[model samples]
Target: MALRRRALGLALGLVWGFAVMFSTLWLLFQGSSGEIISQLKYFYLGYTFGYEGAVIGFLWGFVDGFIFGVAVAWLYNYLSMKIYR
Candidate 1:
């Protein structure tokens, strides 16, 4: 079965974006700075452990997840076509 690239991308983008946003909020509410969360700033520029940072992280995560999902789906389809032919 072939995977729909855009559908997979969108699904992954939403999941990843929400994951980052919620994780940030969770840490913020807990009143502790997360080491892992803080590390995201290095990869996602402008990201910090603050309210505004949650939005930034979400955007970065969405783009990153979307590209990764699309790439994976494309590779899967390409390999399946080659093998089934």
Candidate 2:
């Protein structure tokens, strides 16, 4: 694949991830705290490792964001691959 293609895919992935995070958070917030507390706990479970817990939480959340971004790229690549194949 060309560099341009990769760059475009990455950009699209970041955008898709941002949208998904926003939508998911919005949906989660629509209900009372009692309704979504457990989900948030599970969502942030990636932060439960070593080091300072709070910093770990923030950093892990950043990672989660990037992974979500990559997922967007993955979907774009999938579509491209399908079309080209």
Candidate 3:
């Protein structure tokens, strides 16, 4: 059951990270998406997409999202254990 819980946490964390990356970019770069597109460099992972943010805002947001996701997951796990126990 712990594995399931951890998996759920991880999935949620990833989604949150992507969301944060996109939304933050939009909010922060509203009206400048095109201006930042030229700065992006598409990246790929093993048979998977890595980073493909064309806009600077999105790229920045994407990175922030990754960080936020990890932090959020950690916080979630910690809080779950602390409060539930």
- CA RMSD per model (angstroms): 0.8, 7.0, 8.0
lDDT on C-alpha atoms for all candidate structures: 0.94, 0.50, 0.47
Clashing pairs in 3: none
- Name the regions of candidate 2 deviating beyond 4 angstroms: 1-39, 46-54
Residues 1-85 of candidate 1: C-alpha lDDT, one tens digit per residue: 9999999999999899999999999999999868878999899999999999999999999999899899999999999999998
- Residue 17 lDDT in candidate 2: 45
In model 3, which regions exceed 4 Å deviation?
A: 1-54
TM-score of 2: 0.37
Candidate order by decreasing TM-score? 1, 3, 2
| Among all candidates shown, the one with the greatest lDDT | 1
Model 2 clashing residue pairs (backbone): 13-73
lDDT of 2 at 21: 51
- Best model number under TM-score: 1
Position 36, candidate 2: lDDT: 38
lDDT, residue 73, model 1:
100
How do the residues 1-85 of candidate 2 rate in per-residue lDDT, one tens digit apiece?
Answer: 4224455545655554454455445544564333432344465664332223334444445556556666666777788788988
